[model samples]
Structure formats: C-alpha cells, structure tokens
Target: MFPLVMIASLVALGLLVVYYVGGYLFQNRSLSDIPAASPWAALTRFWLVREARFGRRYLTVDDAHKTHGDFVRIQPNHVSIANVNAINAIYGHGNGFLKSDFYDAFVAVSRGLFSTRSRADHTRKRKIVAHTFSAKSVMQFEQYMHQNLNELLRQWDLICQKAPANSKFARFDCLPWFAYLTFDTIGDLAFGSPFGMLKNGQDTIEYMDYPGGPSKYMHAVDALSRRGEAFAVLGCLPFLKKIGHLLPDSFLRNGVRSGSQVAGIAIARVGERLASTATKGTERVDILTRLMEGKDVKGQPLGREELTAEALTQLIAGSDTTSNTLTGIFYWLLKSPGVLAKLQAEVDTVILSPTDEVAFQTVKNLPYLKACMNEGMRIHSTSALGLPRVVPIDGPAIEICGRTFEPGTVLSVPNYTIHRLESIWGADSDQYRPERWESLTDDQKKAFVPFGHGPRSCVGRNVAEMEVTLAMATLVRRYDFELYQERFETWEGFLRKGFCCEVGIRRRMT
Candidate 1:
C-alpha cells in the first residue's frame, strides 16, 4: 500500500513539471499570430540567451526581422517590433509603458535613471538631473572636451612624427585613443579634474584612497561590460541565475566588483568635491556639484548614495556613447573614400587652422558633417539591441502590427534592425551614404532613432552629439586615414561597440 502511494506521488510530480515547463505556450496563446525567432524561443528564453552568449544577439534580432516581417517573438512573452509606428505607443511619456525589469541586472545597489523601474522614481530623478544635461548646461563642458581632444590630437601628432618617412600612414587604433579621450572628458566634466588619460595616453583612474597601486576606470567598466554581456544573456534563465549565485569565486562576481570600484571612484570624487568646497568655501563647477545641488520635485536633494549613482551613470554613459559613436563615424568615413573626401572638403572649407581645436559652434550646423554623423549613428546602433520596455500592468490593451497585446506583454525595438531595414531606408541602406539624409521624407526621418525617441530617450545625447561632431571634424581637418586591415569589423559588446581595428593615420599633405 505504501509503495503504491509513493509511485502515485512521483507520477503527479512529473506531470506538474511538464505542465509548468510548457506553461509559457498556454499563457501566451494570444500571441499565436506573432512569428517566433525559433520554435525553442516560444518555450524558453535560452534561444535568445544562446545568441547573446556568442555576442551576436543583434544579428539574431536583425535576422528575425528579415524573416518574420515586423513583429517577431524574441521570447514567450517578449516581442520585437521594428516599425516606427510603435515608437509613440511604447516609449512616449503618456503611453504608460515602463522600462522592463531586465534593467535590474545593471544596477549595483540604488537604481539610477538608466535602470529604475519605478515611474514616479524615474520622473523625480530625471527632473533632478535633467537640467545638468540640458543644452545650455552641457555647453559648459565644452572646454573640457576641447582640452581632451587637443590632448588626443597631441598624442596622434607624436605617432604621426614617429612614423617612418617612407610610410604613407601611421598605424594607430582609434579604439583605445577614443576611450582615453572620452573618459578624460567625462572625468573633468563629472569631477573637477580629468582622469589624465589624454595626458598619459592611458586609462588611469587615480584613487589616492585606494590601497592597490593601479586603477583604470575604463578597464573596470570593460570588466563590468563583459560580465554584463554574460549576465544579460544567461541571466534571462531563472535556473541559470540561481546557479550563477551558487558558484564560488566565479568570473560573474567580477562585474559587481568592477562596478563597486567604479562606485568607489565616484564616491571619492564626490567626497573630494564636498570636502574642498566645505573647508575652503569655494564653488566647484562640475556635474557632481550640480547633482548635489539639484532638488527633486519633492524639494529633496540627492543623498550620498543617490549622488554617487548619478555621477557613475553620467561617466559610463557619456564616455562610452561619445567614444563609440566617434569610432563608428571614422570607420564609415575611411571605408568610403568618396564620402571621406567630401567630408574633408566640407571641414577644410570651414576651418582656418587644422591644428586648432574644432569649435562646437562652427561644426554644429555644418550640413554634410551633420549628415555624416547621422549616417554613422544609424549604421551603428548605439544600444545594439532593442531598448526593452514593458506594457504597464494597469494600462489599456494596445494594438501593434495588426494584433492586440494585453497588459504584461513585453515589447522592444532594436535600433540596429530598424536603422538597416530596406523599407525604412532604401535598398542601399546597408551602404554608407551621408547624402541619403538630404532626401529623407517625413516618414523616413521619423524612423531615425540614433538618440532614440520621446522623453525616455538618452539624456546625454546633446553632449554626445556636440563632442562627437567637434572631435570628428577636428580629426578630418587634421589627418588622412585608411583602414589597416582589408576589412573592418567589430564585436557587439554591451557598450562601446564599433570599429575594433587599427587605422593608418597621417597628417594630410596639402
């Protein structure tokens, strides 16, 4: 009698496992019309996770869009929509869409603007920090940009002189140079001082308080990025996440360790700023100071933790975005000689001295220069994957791609796929053509989402655009460059993904 009872219990357990394992299908039956990336995608997040693990998830989204039309099921509940029509519905302020919990993986402790899921919280934080990133406020950082770009040019000048006279070009990887320059710029803009990356030609984050000898802020961010890539893919699986936490002394922990190090740097910078200002009673002008001084809608200033998180957010987002966009712009320009020549002509016509810093105001309104920038940004989606946002649990059902999606459904639009779509862009969308911007109709222009669309769009975009435009025009005005390798390629990391190749550079001989 006891044995029979035990056998019956085992059978019931097996049945329950099967039902719940396949429950994703039954729950999402309303999404039957939507095409899945694969048969497995409907059952598990592992399929998408596999693409992410290989660092080709962007390709997966792009391939799915090509095969499945507009709406593709990336997971059982998650769908990727490429049409511009969904922009206002998903990301619009009044649309009631909230950022998905997927961003929770990025936050170290206290959630900042990038990862916070609470609408009220984000609204308050955005209100507090929004002024610091405004056009007028961002221009205050222009001097920092000029100083760093000049230092970068000085480094490249040294490399140019070091080149053998017989050689037509000097080989220098703009990848790290861009990184160094951007970090230094952000450092000076964030704290009262730069990281000295440009002066040193290396990523050096000095912490007088740190016990260990060397500190590279960019390296910490890189380590965090690698681990973020891993977590982003694998963390989708609940069992895998559980297993990850169980592993002792694993590489996964490095992400948090690196993030804490970055946090330490921000905290240290804040402390220094606070300390100097308090004792000396001197005013220090930087992003951190603004963050500390700014008040939320509640009229509450940021606490120490909140202040650190905001500072770290600005540094990471600003440096990576500017550096990567500049990298993409140069890569495209070098790959297309006619485009390069045209851009150079445009810049040369405007600038009296190639050696002087490219002033932001001078290049800000240049048509071809702006066109080149827009093209580069479109070709290389800064975010890579779709910026995922969820349908609010309490909001009304919405229609997308001729189907109704109830609350609790997930939606996103991958910038990479949308930017390269043949319908949105012409058949030559894959090609680098700055001139395409000139003929863009109202509909075509609406699809352009380099800085994203709506209120939730990147706050640091103004600063990023100004600095990139200035830096790119400056480089083109001063140097002639060619790709060192026969072909240019890059791996899509979590951030700063573009042009992982050496460029042969030389002073343009007039």
Candidate 2:
C-alpha cells in the first residue's frame, strides 16, 4: 500500500510538470506569432541551454535564423534577433532595455562595468572612468604599449635568427605570444607595470600556473569562459553540480575558481598600487592611477570595490579582444598574400621598419591597414554571440520588425550573423576582402560592431584599436609570414574559441 501511494504521487507530479510546461509555457504569452526554432524553445530554454553547454549556441542559433527567418524564439521569453535595425532599437543609447539576467553569470566581482545591469549604475561608473580612456590617455599609453611590442619583436627576432638556413623559416605559434603581449600591454596601462609576460615568454597570471605544468592566464580565462558556457546551460537544470565528477569544466570547479583567481589578482595589483604611493617616486601614471584620483561630479571618489572591478574589467576585456582580433587579422592576411602585400605597401609607405617601434598615431590614419583591421573584426567579431538585453514590459510594447515582444522579453542580436548578412554586406560577404570596407554606405558602416555600439560598448575601444594597428603595421613591415600549421581551428565557447595562427616568419630582405 505504501509503494502504491509513492508511485501514484510520482506519476501525478510528472503529469503536473508536463501540463505546466507543455500547456502553459508553450502557449506564447505576448510574443505573438514569432516562430520558435523548435517546440522545445517555446516550452523552455532547454534546447538553447544544451547547445550552450557544448559551445555550439551560436552555430545552433545561426542555423535557426536560416531556417526560421530573421527572428527565432530562443526561449519562451527570449528572442534572437539579427537585422540592422534591431541593433539601434536594442543596443542604441536611450533604449529602455536593461541587460538581461544572463549577464549575472559574468560578474566576477559584485559589481563592474561589463556585468552591471542597471543603466543608472552603468552610467555612473562610465562617467567616473571616462577620463582614463581619453585621447590623452591613449597617447600616454603608446610608449608603454610599444615597450611590450618591442619585446614581442625581440622574441620573434630571436626565433627568426635561430631558424635553420635551409628552411629560412621558424615555426612559431603567434597565439600565446599575442596573449602575452596584450596582457603585458594592458598590465602596463592599468598597473604602471606589466605582469612580465612578454619579457618572460610565459603565463604571468599566478593562478593559471596550476599542477598540470604552467598554462596561459588566458587559458584560465578561457576555462572561465567555457565554465560560463556550462553554467549558462546547467544553471537551467537543478543539482547538476552535485555530479561534479562527471563534468570536467563544470561551474563549481574551473570557471568560478578561475574567475575568483583573476579577481584576486586584480585586487592584489590594486593593493600594490596603493602601497607604492608613499615611496619617494612620483605618482604612477596609468588608468588605475587616474581611476583612484578621479571624483564624480558629486565629489565622490571611486570606492575600493569600483576600483578593483574596473581594473579587472580592463585586464580581461582589453587583453582578450585585441589579441583575438590581432590573431584573426594575421590569420586572414597570411591566408591572402595579395591582401597582405597591399596592406604592407600601405604601411611601408609610412617609412616604418621591422626593428622600429611603430607609433599608434603614425598608423592610425593608414587606409588599407584600417581596412584590414575592420575586415578582420568583421570576419571574427570578438563578441560574436548575441549581446542580450531584456525588453521593459512595464514601458511601451516592443516590436522588432513585424514581431511584437511583451515586457520582460529577452532580445539579443548576434554580430557574427549580422556581419555576414548578404543584404547589409555585398554578395561577397563570406570573403575576406578588405577593399569591401571602402565602398560601404554610412548605414552599412554603422552595422559593424566588433566592440559593440552606443554607451554600453567597450570603453577600451580606442586603446585596442591603437594596439592592434600599431602591432599589425609593425609586424607586416618587418616580416613576411606563412601559415606553418595545416590544422588551425578556433576554440569555440560562450565567448570565443581557441583560434591560434602558427606561422613561419622570415625577415623581409629590405
């Protein structure tokens, strides 16, 4: 009798879930007539979560767009939108949509620029730190950026110098070097000194130096990214973390640990800066320095939490985005020697050298170099996945294209898909042609958002562009590189994949 009662209760609970999920959740509340990618999406974000866990969300969403047209119901309350106009309504300044709760997963600290959801909080933070990213700041950061670039060139020069004469080529992977260079550069700009990555030719972030031999700090960052991928999925399911042994890069282990470790590094570096002030030396000139002294209009300085959060944001956002794009730029350029030669000609005409540290201002105005960067960014948008923003149901009704979304709806536009949309770009959208940039209309130009758009866009955009342009100009003018490794693949995750370009570089005979 006891067994019968238990079995009956279990059966009743299963039917209740089925009725609630299938009957109620599947019936579109206010997202009238928007076609779901599958019935599963209308019922729950189960399909989306599963795809994200495997790092295949973008590919899956992209396929859905192709099948279901521009808008696909990604969840019962979430819609993945991919059109040029959607960008303005969703991400443009003054839009009422707040960042969705999906962002809570990325807040390393309690608060920061990247993860802060409230528009008021974001704006307040943005105003206080805007000076750190000013044109004057970029000009000052140039010397520090070049110092790291010089080290990178020195390292590459050593490789070229030691290569066998018969081959006249050194097989080297530029990915880790790019990571190290960016880390060192951002370190100098944020911390008055670099983490010694370029100088040491190794991972500098201490937590990354785990038991399985040493690894790149960015690898831990990557693990954190993949960890977000797992959480974004497993979070939808309850008690999945209990089976921690089954999940290698599960939420509790790698992601949280890596994120917490990176945050500690940021906080510790801040502690170091605070301690250095009493020394006989003048004040350290870096973003963090500016941030510390900066006061809001209300005469309040940034609190310790704000300071640490912003500094970590700079290190992570500034380093990864630039390195990935630089890697992408090199990947595209080497694969297309004709484009490389054209860019080389454009940059070489400026009287730069392989051995000389190229200034950001010198290459800032170069047309083809700018074109190459833009083209590379388009091909591999750093923020390729959808930047999700929740619609305000309490405000006016939101209608994207012909579809109307109710309040509390989640809207995301993927630049990865939009970048290659045949309508916005030409028929050759899939190709890596830099010249395509020259003929783009103003509206077409607005559609390019590698760093994102409006107030919420990347604050370090200028610094990133400066670093990439200078590095690209310097590298192209100095060496002619050929892709050495036949097997090159992008590491796919919630953020980006592991796309590294291993190239055989030889000094130009000039």
Candidate 3:
C-alpha cells in the first residue's frame, strides 16, 4: 500500500512539471519576436508580481525597455512599450483597446470612473460629472483651495517661528503636510465639509459607525497608501485577489483591511452629505451637490451606491495625485538651486504677501514657475507605471511601436520610460531641467502625458493643476527649502507614491 501511494504522488508531481514546461514553451513560441525582461518573465506572471511586491516594478520595466528596443515582455502576455506613438493607438478614442482586467483589483465599492473597463460605462460616468470637473467649475471651488492654503500657511508659520532654539530653519516632512492640505481641500470640495486633516496635522478622519449611529476616526491616509501598494501588486494578475486570504503575506491582508476602511469612509461621507441636504435644505453648490443633481445612464438621479463610488473616486484621485505632484515640484526645486532661484524670482514678482492666498490666474501666467511645474511632473511623474490596456480578443490585430500584436495581448506604455526617452526629449531627458519645456517640439509635446491622454484622460486635470500650482507658488514664495536627505526615495504602486520628503524651511528674507 505504501509503495502504491508513493508511485501516485510521483506521477502527480511529474505531470505538473510537464504542464508548466509545456505551457512555457508554447508562450515563448507565440511571443518569439519580443525580448523578455527575464527568462522567468516569459514563463510566468509571478516575475512581475514579485517586482511589484517589492515596489520596483516600474524601475524594473524601465530598465528592460532601455535594454530591449521599443517593447519588452514584462509578463508572458503583457508587453511594456516605450514608444510615445503607442499612447494614441492604445488609449486614444475609437482605438478598439480597452482597460485591462488589471483595474478590477482597484474596485473598492463599485467600478468607479478610473477603474471602469467598459467604454460605454466610462462615457456615461464621464458625462454625469464632466461639467463639475470643467475649468469653470474648478474656478468656482478656488475659495476652498484658498481656505485650506491659508490654514496650511498658518501652521507652517507657527512651525517656522518655533524653530529649534537657535536654528533659522524649521524641519518637517513635506509629504504628509501636502497630503493633509490636499485631503482637506478635496474632502471639502467633494463632501461639502473639510476633513480637518490640515488643522489637526494628521491623516485621521471621521466616518460613519452605522446609518445615523455615530462617527469613528481612522488613519485614512495610511490606508490609502497601503491600498495603492497592494492594488498595484494584485492588479497585475487579478486572480491573486481570490486566494489572497489564504496567503500569509501581511501586506495583502492589511490591504484588504485598508480597502474596507476607505470604502466605509466614502459611504459615510456620502450618506452624511445626503442627510444634511434633505434635512437642512441648505442652498450650496459644491461638487457633491452637482453630482446629486446629475442624471445617470437611466436618465434618473444617481443611486446612493453609484454616488458613493464616484465620490470615493474623487477623494482618491484628487488627494494623492495632487499632493505627489506638489511634493515633486518642491523636491526638484530644492535639489536645483538655480531652478529654485529662477522660480522664486518669478513667483516673487506675482506674490505680494507671505500669507496671501496666491490666486490661480497670477501663478498660471508665470513662465518660469510653469516650467518648473512641468519639469517636476515630467521627471517625477506620480503615475510612473504603465497604464495597462488590452487588445480586443475578438478584434483584429493592432499595431504598436512598428510591430503587430494580436488580440488579447497586454500593452502598457510606462510614462516613466516615455518621459525619459532620449529620442524625443534629447540626451538630457533624465536630468531635472525646467528649461527643457521652454521649447517643445510637436513630438515632445505628444509624449508629455503626465495626466495621461485621450478621452479617458483625468477629468480633474484642471482642478489638480490649480491646486498644485496654487500651493507650490504659495509655499515657494513664502519659504526657502533645504533638503534634509541627499536622495528622494519613491515606492511603486498604482501611482508612483512618495515617501517622506524631509526639509528645513525658513521664511525668505527677500
């Protein structure tokens, strides 16, 4: 009996090995033309998964693109393309390509605007809130931005004044501070009330205990950060999400908890806003009110669930992306003294007071300031990883990077790699030089997609730009930053998330 059991176990092990090897050989044969990032990458999705787990997926893919020509197989079926032309072909309107299943991992409540895969669904969702995100609409919300900006300045001023006994400069981490400002600003804009993150100088926020029950406080920013990292890893091969519970990885388990917390927060905010409107009958027009008034695909007001999803999307999209950009702007500014001086001079011309809330119109017109913003965005893109898209399984083969790829092939144009392409941005593409944006050719312009391109581009682009510019101008005009760390460290997630950026701030004498 023991001999017979051993023989069966040996047979099962041999069969599994044969299956894996056979499948690997078949995949290699099919994608024979494209170069693989590694031998294991051509065999399994686990290679990319491991890289993502370690927060080096973007960097690893970027290196592979540099080694291989235009395209590199980061996974068996997924190709990471460095060509700018592929952006339009893959993400442009009427381009047959659709968002891959990778996005489904990010669906916390429901498929929000950013996570939705269906073209029709995305179009419907876009129409519902398009006006709310327009430039004119964003302009209406400038007061909220200014309000938070003033609060941020007040806090910073106190810190600077209380600088260590004899030290002229005060030390603080800009990343969390920026996060607090953006979080409070977006919460006010979206939910009709600020989260008070800025005033408290913490990432904690209140959410519903139950319907009309009570409110609970949680570390909202930490959850969002962990969610980004977990989602980035799981999204690569969404199947992992199913068996994720069985896995012993603490990050994945913590991610699930974090996702639930974010979802609860969104639900509570939406519910509270709705309850306030119904009972108080206040006449205020904010993003939430507009969304409440907007019609859904069925020509009816959006349901609570749908509203929660969209509201949650706005909070996530508006906060980290803008904060990361602002952090990058300051990081690069402090790193390049010449650039910082030129930008400070430009900002000084427009900004009249240290405590004044810098207007968008004034800051928007500053050429050198705009250059630094563009350069910072280009060099330290928040969404550094490739936005993944898929060829239709039933449609004809599509062309990218002068190569024909069949349907069902995953194509990702990593912005990190594209922004640094030597052919388009010249040899100094890797350098953090604001002067590069002074004269951009048509080709270079096409490649500069910090917020992405096409119909699916960020609807909140106008708002994000306004917030980042306003905050950057205000801060740069008031204070001079000295870097505490020699190098800026970044972690990979859905967006290229930032770690702490510690710096010494002193009130500018001039």
RMSD each, Å? 4.0, 4.2, 2.9
Top lDDT prediction, candidate number: 3
Tell me how candidate 1 scores on lDDT.
Answer: 0.77
The reply for model 2, stretches above 4 Å from the true place, is 1-27, 207-252, 278-282, 485-488
How many clashes does each candidate structure show, in the order listed? 0, 4, 0
Clashes of 3: 0
- Taking the tens digit of each residue's C-alpha lDDT, what string does model 2 give over 408-508? 87899987889888878878887889988788886678789888888888888888988998899989999988886554466445456455688898898
Model 2, C-alpha of 298: deviation from truth (Å): 1.6
Order of the predicted models by lDDT, top scorer first: 3, 1, 2
| Pairs of residues at least 3 apart in sequence or in different chains that clash in candidate 1 | none
Q: Tens-digit lDDT track for model 3 on 259-301?
A: 7678778889888888887899756667888788888678877
lDDT of candidates 1 onward, in order: 0.77, 0.76, 0.85
User: Which runs in model 1 stand beyond 4 Å of their true positions?
Assistant: 1-23, 206-218, 234-253
What lDDT score is found at residue 325 in candidate 3? 86
User: Any idea how many clashes model 1 has?
Assistant: 0
Q: What's each prediction's TM-score?
A: 0.91, 0.89, 0.94
